[model samples]
Target: MAHYARRRCRSACAGKEVSLMKKVHVIGGGLAGPEAALQAAAAGCEVTLYEMRPHRSTEAHQTSDFAELVCSNSLKSESENTAPWLLKQEMRRAGSFLLKEADATAVPAGHALAVDRVEFSRRVAEAIAANPRITVVREEVISLDESGDHITVLATGPLTSPALAAELQRLTGSDQLAFYDSIAPIVDASSIDMEKVYFAARWDKGTADYINCPFTKEEYDTFLDALLTSEKVELKEWEKGQYFEACLPIDELARRGRDTLRFGPMKPAGLTNPKTGRWPYACVQLRQENLRADSYNLVGFQNHIKYGDQAKVLRLIPGLENAKFLRYGQIHRNTYINSPAVLNGTLQLKAHPSIVIAGQLSGVEGYTESIAGGLLGGRFAALLARGEEPVAPPRQSAHGSLLHYITHAEAKHFQPANITFDLLVPLEEELRKKIRDKKERHRLQCERALEAWGAWLAQSALPVG
Candidate 1:
């Protein structure tokens, strides 16, 4: 999920920014909506944040709090050389409110920004409640009209309610609203066979935060055979979009090769079974999905297989034979308009400038990426409301790469994306420096990004005190 952080600095701007006292409506109170609300409120816009909970609920959320995380608790890595770490650093420099809160409540997880889910959600709810400029409405919005006098931002997230989804379809003049995003299963920690699974992080990097279930040559072959032959859930008529590679189900991975599992999610890198003192032939690593540490999710194991087949076939792993599933893998239709065809870099829909779409609903994936999208989009919407010039981060920046990817990616093949160095513009020719080390090269890229981003922020003339 998306998160924010803040750096304290003395105020530098000396002019009064335009005030948008007029009310702005932000639909959905997940990561994106709240970020949008916070940004707009900070810009002097009176934001009405709508969240459908308590009275109405989604399948994934168990609480009424805003910005709930339905999956893993860790926010990936915090190493500056990593792409995610650079992204977080960029967000903090951009004055991201959500990141500020996340950093404030972060828990130790080696180099990851893990948090107590209960405390995180509660803090988010309290922050929004305390913002006098934001009015939290616990009502589900069925639909929105583009003809309205005020702007509306739809950050409804992946599990958008059916009624509002239908309304969105009507507004877009297309039958594109979708439901059913299948998540991978989480396993009960007590059930895993500790003797068979080893604790290690990839490349001996970071901390021993993962439990890896290894497979030998013979066992991997059998598992592949079972995965390929296992029955899969039939797709519905409207649920026909091709699965994104990052989230490809195990069955699909199996079809790629007899040895694909060994190379893909089950790769036996940076791990050695204590018994043999050697890396296993293949492996499946389970990461903590909650702060309680009572459960772990099968990393890279999202699937659309029949639930029964999942239990029967997945248990073939050496450590998962008696696994008790906290959640089952299943596939559902996800819907999004061709963002390149519908939205600008600022996330404004092309045909209607007053409307913006954020989060997974806009074809961006992962939690933090979605939050970054909202935070940036919110700033743009605030600029639009105040009639100020819109700002875009330099292409060298992570935020700019994401904005460019969603707005300029080939519409026909558009898929959800996570912020990565590959998506950013190539480094300067003069600065190539003939570096061969990947980590050192990444450090150079990040250094360039920070300098460019600082220049961009300092040059942008925002009307703020």
Candidate 2:
């Protein structure tokens, strides 16, 4: 069996003739690394996937499972209306293995692609394990020789091992690896004062799902004061202070202004409190955290507050007066590279052309975005393995915009991003000025992106089969 496997690998390496067996080593068995390995394997290259799980664990992940959705189980929207939705569509068309598993394991989440986290990871792991050309190795890779010619994809993700992280720092010559992301707390459903809370999804367009804790003007002011004054978890000495804007802690929001949250995530424009028969001054909305409906997470309430402070201050909210915390919000480290400064459009490090960085490591945010990066990195790496030069997605597509941002955006102001219309190539000047409705405009952008992405895929010489 060993001899046959070796022979097969050798045959794949150079069409059964070359002496040297060409193989791709993918470090990190998370979304990007496994995907990269699978792609390379599919393209007739032997792939050895190194995963540091079970033996070594990161701050975010608790399981030995590969491609674990540590933070969120939702893969965002599956509709074509959202940029992430469009990106998923593009990835599907491009034969993304991850997307196939996600589809198979998908749970009902309205329009979003939510999944049983365990099942999702298990499915992904099984796929990687079953792939004949891919070998899964359980070990930590603490170093990489960026000067070498071999292609190495670093998908170590946000919770990268410390030693490898240091090695990455040495290679990049930048202090950009991050180590702190905050999660929102979930409250026990039975504990909340439902009399003061109302069930309503935003815009009343979806199911009457979210439990909103209504706040009057005085209540909101007091809440803001408490939030601002609440004790916070301090950063570690060695860890850099960086919070992705989308998940900024409430304390950081408080620093902006008393009304910062009111205008930002706490904005309650559409729903009216059922008990009061009016929209509250501002609302703290909670969504069912699990399918069991026992706990509900505070939407837009990601925080770094001390556990005691979290309990005390969260209780101050109108409906949460007697709330029992199911999970206390905690902060963990998130690592990433300064993509704009170090990476090209393909997420390959400029100084180390053979190494490609994907996922949050490339400065993109959200689960889907991370998977998308992995998808692209895998395809790019496979093409390179085939001796075909890597190709960038068209600038008009979401993937293209992300790559463009990582490679070309101003390094001084580089920020991790989720897909947004602003990232897309601008619509024609005539269309931009003429479009009045934002949703309609976004739809137009999506349409154009699909068209452009299709054409680009057709033109690319990479073997789609």
Q: Residue 283's C-alpha lDDT in candidate 2?
A: 87
- Alpha carbon deviation, residue 218, candidate 1 (Å): 2.6
Q: Between which residue pairs do clashes occur in model 2?
A: 178-334, 178-335, 179-333, 179-334, 180-333, 180-334
lDDT digits (tens) for residues 221-279 of candidate 1: 88878888888887766566467667667788788877777778788976777778889
TM per prediction: 0.87, 0.87
Query: Which candidate number has the best lDDT?
Result: 2
| lDDT by residue (tens digit), candidate 2, 1-465 | 121122223465556654333467788877777777777777777788888888988766668888886665677776556888888888887778888888887654455676666677888888887999988889989989664345677898888888988888888898865646766677898898888787886666546767888888999888888888888887677656666777877788889888888887688788777676777788887766555666777866778888898888889888899899977777677878888888877777878777888888888887788888887887777666555568899999889987888788888877778887778887788997999888898898888888888888888755453
lDDT value for candidate 2? 0.77
* Stretches of model 1 off by over 4 angstroms after superposition: 1-20, 54-64, 104-111, 166-182, 459-465
Clashes counted in candidate 2 amount to: 6
User: What is the lDDT, from 0 to 100, of the residue 183 in candidate 2?
Assistant: 65
